[model samples]
Target: MIGKLNHVAIAVPDLEAACITYRDALGASLSQRQELPEHGVTVVFIDLGNTKVELLEPLGENSPIAQFLERNPTGGMHHICYEVPDIRSARDRLLAEGARVLGDGEPKIGAHGKPVLFLHPKDFCGTLVELEEV
Candidate 1:
């Protein structure tokens, strides 16, 4: 099933400003900005010792992050990702247990360049859960 806490994603209005806040103000090292057109987000990763924090900015109007921003103008936690030994197996288990998977219920390439699937928020205490194959 799920393994270690992979990363926590935050939807932000401004990617640069968020990076600056984490870099200059919080003394965190930021990774290079990566634009994921397929997922519709431009992201920056703040590397913490054990886990990473992902800052996401909408790449287009249809981006999910954009909708999230519309709800919380100042931005907020978008989702939390957990590592999985095998994404397909984990997905099947979740499906059998009656958990809804987002999108087509298939894994897509995620920010980490790994196969990832997002579970429905309502199925997980209103918190979006992402499972990444490690």
Candidate 2:
């Protein structure tokens, strides 16, 4: 099943502004910006002692984030990630429970370089959920 809360991902129209807000205004420590081409996002992570906050910007026109931004011009919370001991097992359990997995129904490398899978937002009360293997 699900484990600890991994991180909350927020889509931002402007990555630099979002970084400044979190780094300067909120005084948070942020990781260097990293481009995840496979995920079609450029991301920066803010360290939060117990968890992290991920700020994501669309990397290309076809980026899923781009589609999200089109629907929500201002950008907002995109998804919440949770850790799992075994991603495949977790995926199977979710499937058995009638939860839909996004994409090819396989785990992909995530921001933390760990295996991750996204569940359909509609299946989780309109909130996108990500399962990351720990």
Candidate 3:
């Protein structure tokens, strides 16, 4: 079941520059930053009140964000992640509804060590859907 609205991820080419804008300029504090080699990207989190704004920078050409950035030259919001009580069940529900997954099966390592699965945006009205177990 989808629980809470988690952090909104924004794709950016420069994580450091984005962090400075959100932190020093916008008054949001840097929460955390992590590099996921498997995903080929680096993420920096900025706490904004109760929610967090995540900045994503592609580590290489194979990174999902790299493709995103290439398409959107301005670099904007990439995807929204919703917290779920049980990711496996959530994914099952989505798949039963004819939603396609990027991977063959099972949850994968996500930002902040969360287990996550994605539902094809095309099946969900072009909104990229990410399910994370909190």
By TM-score, the best candidate is: 1
lDDT, candidate 1, residue 38? 84
Off by over 4 Å in 1: none
What range of 10 consecutive residues in model 2 has the weakest lDDT sum?
A: 60-69
Alpha-carbon RMSD, each predicted model: 1.1, 1.1, 1.5
* Candidate 3, superposed: residue stretches over 4 Å from native: none
- lDDT for 17 (candidate 3): 82
Please report, as a residue range, the 10-residue window in candidate 1 with the lowest summed lDDT: 60-69
The digit string of per-residue lDDT tens for model 1 on 17-100 reads: 898888889999898999988889999988899999999999965997887899999999999999999999999999999999
> Which residue pairs clash in candidate 3?
none
Which lDDT values do the candidates have, in the order given? 0.92, 0.92, 0.83
Instruction: TM-score each candidate.
Output: 0.95, 0.94, 0.90
lDDT of 3 by residue, 1-134 (tens): 67778888899978888888888888887867788778888888877777777888998668987878989976898888889988888888887988798777699978668899887888877888888899
Model 1 misses residue 64 by how many Å?
1.7
Query: Weakest 10 consecutive residues, lDDT, candidate 3?
Result: 45-54
Candidate 2 Cα misplacement greater than 4 A, ranges: none
* Residue pairs in clash, model 1: none
Residue-level lDDT of model 2, residues 1-134, one tens digit each, is 67899999999999999999998899999999999888889999988999999999999668878888989888899999999999999999999999999999989888778999999999999999999999
- Residue 68, candidate 2: alpha-carbon lDDT: 88
Tell me how candidate 1 scores on lDDT. 0.92
